[model samples]
Target: MRQPGGDEDGTEPGDGEPGSRLAALGGLHLEEAPPDGGVPATGRSPRTARNRTLIVSALLAATLIACLGTAVHLFLRINEPSSAERPPPPPPPRPGASMSGPAGGGPRPVAQPVRTENDLDMVCADRFYPSAPRFRGSAPHPVMISEGEETGADFRSTRTLNRAAFAGSATQRRTWAPDPERAQIVACLDLTGPGRKIRDCRAGDGTLPLVEGRYRLAVYEVATRRRILQKDLTGTDRACPFVIRTGAGDTLHSAVKDQQLYDLLHQRVEG
Candidate 1:
């Protein structure tokens, strides 16, 4: 039999039924609900949402990579040395010393000092004329000779002597002449000897004289009072008769027929 306001199943229309209870519990609606009554749609599809998420993730990854790269660049720049901050290069190695190794290794040969002609000239000028002195009159001092004529040739001879003095064969101390500008009294030959009358000896002022028969030749060191050579020549048997007596009293006679000394004297006389 049918009941009032009940269905055939014997449950009332609005009563707690299985379908209604399920609908209430599940919060589902069979018909479309009002806009303000149910959960609202996000107005975006699932695929669209996923795509937006992937785009954001990609942007974040790129930004992170850029920051890491920038940090690495900064680190490298800070560690690098600038030109001014860098240490200076080492100096060049000295002569005769090996760049590598020590003792027992053969020492490298050292280069000898080289002297030029101009250097020799300057040395001669200094040795010949050291200082200026007042003479009796404007008549250029009798002892002072023209540097251009007298000293030039003598300079050449002195240059030769300098080389000999420094050579390994030299037995005397290596010495050079005084500055010519400081020299007051030039070297002069004392003609009060018998050899001067025999040879008709005539030497330019400030020149070394060439004499014959028992003559003495002496070379006084320029800077000091030391005498290097003092020779006494006697007899006429030798062609260019001359003798060189060292300070040690060792006597060296010139070659019997050698004209080297004569040639040197001729050059001085001509100049």
Candidate 2:
């Protein structure tokens, strides 16, 4: 419904307001001229308004993109561990001692005994040679025991090797462990050093330091629990073949070298 007073806002005819009068007469309003009579200053063009909206939208989009990029960079920097965040590398593998696991088992770490001296002075680079005569008859299976309360390695790996060796060998392979009191022969421990830590273990000029333990071991006939033979007994009986030296100050003072002890019995005693 067209109002009689004006187009909509109630402006009458012949009013000085050109805009309202023109709007009442026609839909288009008159453009007001500039002060210098140059181009007219009119209402904002739709195209120019649309261009400004597009530019503002583009700027906001770019800002949003930059913000996202910065956020992603910060996330990576936070998640990625720095040198301080990373754990220290494991200590490098030790040197010298190179023994591996025992036979028939997976890799058994050669557990080093407590920190003893990593080195020893071979006062005499003495080879194993006992001066006693080779006795007749079969050698008994040695029931391995030790000098103190069995703790630490107790030379356990050596014992593991010995047990495994006996289990594998023919000459001294007795399934039953022999009683020291009742058995015909017993290899008893006579002395042991501070493992591989003793400064000088040599008792005499030619005798070996009681390194691991068996260097001073004695073979005794149980009836008379006296020493029938020491490391000095004749015919190639060894003092102790010093075992291996492992990583970082790891060493074996008197680890028996191999299964040669039973092999010696295999060589000597008559049936």
Candidate 3:
């Protein structure tokens, strides 16, 4: 089997075959066989992959635990009541008792009386007319006639006076009179028939006289009514001058002669 220029042992020239010579020149060596299922084709060990998986799983478990703890904390915070959501405290008990009732057993504190302007007006009205029966003598003193021209004999002769006299009921005359505390008397007169006699009654007697023609006196309160003096002479001559005492021990005199009262009444009635 020896070819031409070949050795007798089937060996090529130059110490080995051409492939072996190339292998030796390239420094190649025989590789050992790998054990079954020991290492993958990717050259990574099975134990290394398992370790990486374990580390990833441990990290995921830690993240899940942290998220669960945060959710629980948030749930508790949302469910708990804040200070602003809490109920208010109860009010303190009254001094007299723990519960309201009759005196001593569970006494209720007495409420103090409150006086209003309406109450004061009511009181002033009541002072002029009382609930109890009063005789003509016991009633408010009549206006006195000191100095005035006595023209007519009786006040009923005047058409105006006659109409006013019969206008009210007997019951109203008994209990009703102008409130003198707050009202101001604008005019006082003693009249006779067709002849009109105007007199300055302020200098005269305190009592307003009702005699002769139409005896009419205007009494008014500017605060309650817009005009103090009536627009027409339609009422009886029963108004008189009165004195009111103030809390400061001063006496306030209200009469027809007051310049302020005369001006205000004249402005309203005349204008």
lDDT of each: 0.34, 0.37, 0.33
* Candidate 2: worst-modelled 10 consecutive residues by lDDT: 119-128
Ordered list by lDDT, greatest first:
2, 1, 3
For candidate 2, lDDT tens digit of each residue in 39-97? 54556666788999999999999999999999999999999999988999997754321
Backbone clash total for model 2 is 7
Query: What ranges in model 1 sit over 4 Å off?
Result: 1-43, 87-271
- TM-score of structure candidate 2: 0.27
Candidate number of the best TM-score: 2
Of candidates 2 and 1, the better by TM-score = 2
Q: State the TM-score for model 3.
A: 0.20
Model 3 regions more than 4 Å off: 1-42, 87-271
Ranking by TM-score: 2, 1, 3
Local error of candidate 2 at 156, Å? 22
TM-score winner between candidates 1 and 3:
1
154: Cα error in model 1, Å: 37
